[model samples]
Target: MDYLRSTFVILTVIMTILTLLPFWRNQAWWVRVWDFPRLQMATLSLLFFLTEMALMPFGGPAAQIVIVLSMACAIYHALWILPYTRLYPKQVRASRLNNLPTLKIVTANVLMTNQQSDKLLALVEQHQPDILVTLETDLWWQAQLNVLENDYQHTLKCPQDNLYGMHVYSRLPMQDPLIQCVVAEGIPSMHFRVTLDSGDEVVLHCLHPMPPSPTEDDESTNRDGELVAVGHTAARASFPTVVTGDLNDVAWSRTTRLFMKISGLLDPRRGRGMFNTFHATFPFLRWPLDHVFHSKDFTLRDLQRLPEIGSDHFPILVELALNPRVGKGQRGLEIEPGDQFEAREKMNNAGVKSRHVHTAEN
Candidate 1:
């Protein structure tokens, strides 16, 4: 019994230490693989508490101390994941740009297999956004969406049977709408430059990358690599950019945070609520996977999760304003340059790359 207790205690301590290592103590090779320390901390803490309850003789004072420490670690993990409580107060930024917002855009992942085209069309007509992005679109889906071409003159479409099909429609002038094969697998993504009526130039990148799931990719490394590489590209671009899609990753994950840092993009959800979109059929398991991240030049006016239209994912509509007065400093979060460099290097090292497609000059 003493040996078992000691083993449990030692393992718990090791995991707790590992959880704390990612942010500060260690950046060594082994630590990088176990980089998501918060997850380890939470899991290990739960295991320790469960072990104490299962043991024939409950742990003594030492065990009580361990429980307290474990609970603290768990709380820390929760704090990071649920950052809005700690980071955003009153659900609004103090920046001056919030005064005047810009064009409204809608992004939806209408599952290709979903049959309700009329419902989706109805929503599009009702919303009448300046820009619309649809993912998981196949050739048939493309045919169904073609009806909106009358209103939206500028368009980009990459319809496929695979999970990566994407389409973008814009009422504003779109320059250089082209399909880019970012990864080697010929997975198509659309990139273009949009000229808003205000004469502001905004670069738009619409992507639908395969996420890591048991039935999907064997690991999340590819998805992480692709996202980071795109983030690097977006960061380097001159124009203010908007990246929208079903990223297949949660908003609060370490990978997403690293992407935001490298891309210098602002998540509207930071001060707002989590606009969970996926698994529309199962509301309980849904998460904020579909995202619209923009450069600091833009201020979010409003964001809402639209009603479902037979797809497994709900649409996200956001109204943004070009806040010329809003500078990068208005971003409440601070990310280290070293971490950004490391994230970019890791992405490049993984062999995932992005390609730029130049549309014809308007």
Candidate 2:
């Protein structure tokens, strides 16, 4: 009984610390990684709190303190994720008038090593998105996706074996298409202007920065830096914009929120659901590493997390309408009091000195 009580107390303390770590603006991968599991942490914290309460009589004052702290952690974590749930107001307004011009996009990370082109191709054919952005694509994956070239005529390819590759294919005509590395070496993000069938032009930026994991980089600095840089670019762009890809960060992270404020873009998932996309193989462990954010000029037509396609990540499909008139109703974010200084600090810490994209080699 004593051992059990000790173990529980230790775990509660650790989880409580993890729940508060992301608030400090620390770039350590371990600490920032905690930001990905808020939902899970909330659940676990609640469970721990209940268990602590049940055992409070058997224990002592220390047990009481643990129970109270765990309860607080549970509440805080829940509040952090509440906005991403249906309970909160949607940041992007939904459009009922489907008659308006819409752009449907499907963004997927092919898991670089996962040889499942057929599954992805099937989804593409079924969804028939106006634009398709694939991340972690290698030369082999690019070749596999070549079949899409006929339908998606405007193509931009940045295939690499480095697991940071990207490719964009669009049925609509695209202008000023660019492939750029916004942070780390060999990692590429795509930037372009797509002319909708209605003849309206919208700028698009796609990213798949490396996560803070042992398999990848040491910290979230580069990831945060790339996002700030992109956010700044999106803010200054003349046309309405959309940014999408496997961002390698969760929607609830501070960096993501900062990016939203810096760019003035809205997340369609605000009131929809988590739509957790990564770790398709594990039901218990997953988060929304994939994302799509757009300017106030657009409204949500439809959004979905598509069925798994044999990769670690399930693709996300979103349909948005370019309606500037309804933008007033949408919930948007603005730069915070210290946002400029923080953005600059993040950019500097990320060590991302260049935004040049390395062209894909044959």
Candidate 3:
């Protein structure tokens, strides 16, 4: 019993520390990276609490304290994730304007090294999304998806072998198109206007920021900065906007919430489901890295996590109905205090030290 107590107590502290690491808002990869696994942390914390209770039902005060701390961590994470579950009120309302013009999009991250183009092609054909956005695409993926050009006349392609490459194909025509590296060099994001069947023009922004990881970036500064910069742009845009891609940040993360509020955009996932899209190969270790967020001017018609296509990510499909008259029923988020300040700091941190990069064709 003494041995078990010592082991579990130490592990419990470790879990609690890691769970609280993201609160520091530290940009270092090791610290900020913990933001991605809140769900997993909650699970582990709960398990530690329960197992300790069952195994050592009667321990000293220290043991009891450790158990309580574990439970606290679990509750902490659960509260953060609860808004995303059906139990909470939706931030973005359901669509009542089904008759209005709709746009369906499919966003996929075809691992740059993965060669299974047919699986993705088949999935795209099956859903037949009006817009298809592929990330981690290279010159090879560009050639394989040329067939989509037959149906999707308006296209934006920026194929980079560096794993940040992004490509977009749309059935609806695109205008005022521009592609630029918003933050770090070699990392690119695309922006443009899409004219829907209703003749309404909406700004579409596509991004796949470099994630904070040992193999990738050393900190979350670049990733968070890109999101901040885009959030400001979307907030200021004259027309309604839609932003989607593998943001490299989870839905529940602080950065993501800040983005939503700063941009005044709504996440269809809120009050829906996590719709975990990454690590398609590891079901237990997945989060919603791929996302689609839009202005309240639109409402959700459909959302699904499609079958994996030999990539680390599962494609996500979202169908939205656009009708300016209908969104008044939906709840919207306002920027919180310090949101602008923190966003500015993130942008400044990346801009001051990082090399500027530009890849554009307006």
Candidate 4:
């Protein structure tokens, strides 16, 4: 009984320590990785603390302190994610205009190894989204999705086998189309202007930054740096904008929040749900790596996590309506002098030097 109690107490302390480490703002892959599973951590901490309290009421002062500290850590982690749940008010208001120009987009990261092009095709056919963005596509996936050309008139395709390929297909016409490598080589992000039926043009930025893991890069510097670059681009835009893709980071992460603030975009998931979209095969270990964010000129119409299509990531579909009065008086994250200095430092660390390849429409 003593050994079991000691083990539980040790594990509780370890989890509490891990939860607190992310507050250091360290860019190391291991530390940033902790930002991905706040919900899971909170749940586990709650369960362990409750079990310890119920099973070992007389387990000494150290055990009691550990249990209490673990409980507090659980609440702390939960507070960071609470805004993403229905418990908090939505950051973007719902659209009430019946004739508003609405755009529906589906963003999915088809595992480069997942040969389920047919499933993705069926999903596109079913949803009939105005725009579709796919990540981790290779030459084979590009060929398989080429059939979509019949419906989508404008396209920006960068097919690479290096696990960073991206393709964007749109029914609406695109202007000033560009494909640029934001962070590391072989990874590309798309930026263009898509015109709606109402003649309004919205700037769209698509991204799929590399994730931090043992097999991949050693640090999250590149991912965080790339997001900061894109956020700055979005912030400078004079028109309505939409940014979507598999960010490879969770909504509550510090980097993600900073990106949102710097870009002046709003997340539809706020005050709605977590909409976990990754690790589709493992129900116990899922987080939202897929995202769709838009400027204040837009309001929420609908957002959903689509059914799995044999890939590790569940696709995310977001519908947004354009409203001229949307962002008035809404507070946005201001870029402080320190933030500007940090952004420059991150950009330098990222080593992004590629020029955007501009393609004239056919």
Candidate 5:
């Protein structure tokens, strides 16, 4: 009985230590996987700490192991909750533009099998954003979304039932809209250039890759590979860019962070909050999977989560202001130079081979 108790206690300690692996030295890989089940980790950690305290009266090898496990779990819980503390810090100065051209973009994953087109159309009409991007779209979904054509002049539709299905609609003039297969078969992404009335150009890339799941794709490598490859492409582009879609990864994950660093884009949520968009039905088990990342040439005007439109994922609405005065020093969010090296290594480790495309036009 004593030996069994000891074994259980040791196993618990090991599991507690595993939770803290995210903060260990050079542990980006650890942090990537730690992104999942964050809420459950927090709750379990707290419960373990209380259990250890109650077991103090029964001093033995089991008690000692429980105490150690409790400490480790507590530390990890604290670390996991710390990143959100200064997510969106208060800016020292506000923009001077009184009449800035605010571009509102919305992104939603409409679940390919869902037939509630009326709810989605109602949400879009209510928001009236400048651009709308939908994931998991099929032929029927495309046909239903055609109602948006009167407001949005430009469209790029890749309506497939596969994991990569995507559709994009824009009120601004779009140039060279094309669907590019990023990594695996059936995973397509839409790329286009939006020409604003002020003559400023903004390149937009819409992506929706297959997520990692036991029943779906057993490996997350392809999804990670596709994002990194697209990140590299966006990084090399000269124009200001906005990459939006259902990324299938959390905003704070190593892969997502690396993508932001490599692409040199700014996350509006950084000084704000986690715009948790997935699993709309269960808000508690949600993470910010749908995102809008823009170059520093633009500043955030506003951002919010749209009401549920009968899909598992909620739509993200973001309004950005073009800062004409933003120059070399204030182009966008600045990431440490070392981050790029780490990002490159992670991408390589994920088996993402780099291939450059001259333009999305071809």
Candidate 6:
């Protein structure tokens, strides 16, 4: 019993640290990464708290206090998670009429080493999406996607082996397609205008920012900088805009939330579900790293996570109807006084000196 109590107390202390670390909102990898596993933390914290209480009903005051701390940790994470659940109101309204022109996008981070091209190809064929964006695709993967050219004639390809390669194949007519290296020279993002059948044009920005990991950058600064940079750029777009890709940050993270408010885009996942797409091999350790965020001019037609394609990340498809005529679905994000200032600061801090220009080969 003593051993078990000690174990529970130690777990409680660990959970408490995880809970408090995110509050710092530090761009350091260890601190920011904790934001990605709030769901797991909430569940584990609550479980440990209850199990400890049930097992040690007559524990000393110190043990009881530690148990209570675990419960508090659970509540803190729950508050952040609540907005993404159905219990909270959805940020984007659902599509009521099918007649509106719809733009369906499928975004996936295909592990560069995974050779299951057929799996992704099958999914693209099944969905018949208007635009398909794949990340971490190498020259070999690009060849595998060649079959899509006959269908998705409007193409933008920036193939590299640095695990940041991006390819966008669109059935709709695309104009002025340019691939910009947002932060690093090899890390590219696609910017283009796709004309819909309704004669309306919507700007599409596809990005796969490098994540904050030991193998990758040790800090989240680069990811946060690229995101807010795009956020500011998208904010200036006059046409209806959509940004979809593997953001490498969760929906609830400080940077992501700041990007939302700065860009004034709506997340379809809010009130729908988490639609967690990463760690496809590990069912218990997944989060929504792949995302689809759009301007209020669009409404959710359908958003879903497709089957695994042998990559660490699953594909996410979101069909949004073009209907600014219907009025903004939700109130625009109230850009706090510090939001824009902090956005600029993030870009400055990351030392984003790139011209963000595209090569001649679009």
Per-residue alpha-carbon lDDT of candidate 6 for residues 320-343, written as tens digits (9 for 90 to 100): 998886747476568888887888
Estimate the lDDT of model 4.
0.85
Q: Candidate 1, clashing residue pairs?
A: 101-321, 102-320, 102-321, 176-359
Q: Better model by lDDT, 3 or 5?
A: 3
Worst 10 residues of 6 by lDDT: 353-362
- Best-to-worst order by TM-score is 6, 3, 2, 4, 5, 1
Clashing pairs in 4: none
Report how far off residue 245 is in candidate 5 (Å): 0.5
Model 5: lowest-lDDT 10 consecutive positions: 85-94
Query: How well is each residue in 235-322 modelled by candidate 4, as lDDT tens digits?
Result: 7777788889999899988788888877788888988999999899999899889999888888878899998888999999999998
Prediction 6 global C-alpha lDDT: 0.87
lDDT of 3 by residue, 246-358 (tens): 99999988899888878888899888889999999998999999999998788888999999899999999999888667775676677778988887898898783212222
- lDDT against true structure, model 5: 0.73
Per-residue lDDT of model 5, residues 248-330, tens digit only: 88776666767876777777776456667888898668777898887777776778888888889888998888884652334
Q: What is the descending lDDT order? A: 6, 2, 3, 4, 1, 5
User: What are the runs in model 4 whose C-alpha is more than 4 Å off?
Assistant: 329-338, 352-362
- Candidate 2 per-residue lDDT, tens place, 1-362, comes to 77777888999999988877877867878878898988899999999988877766556678888988899999999998998999998888889786788899999998999997999999999989999999888899988999999999899998888888899999998888778767766988888888888988888889988899877888888899889888887777778889899989999888999999988889999988999998899988998999999988998999999998889999999999988999856767767799988988988887653233221111
lDDT of 6 at 160: 91
| Per-model TM-score on C-alpha atoms | 0.79, 0.95, 0.95, 0.94, 0.84, 0.96
Query: In order, what is each prediction's RMSD in angstroms?
Result: 5.3, 3.0, 2.5, 2.5, 4.1, 2.3
Runs off by more than 4 Å, candidate 5: 1-34, 54-65, 77-81, 85-96, 324-354, 357-362
Q: After superposition, how far is residue 200 of candidate 4 from its true place, in Å?
A: 0.5
Clash count (model 1, backbone only): 4
- Per-residue lDDT, model 1, residue 228, is 82
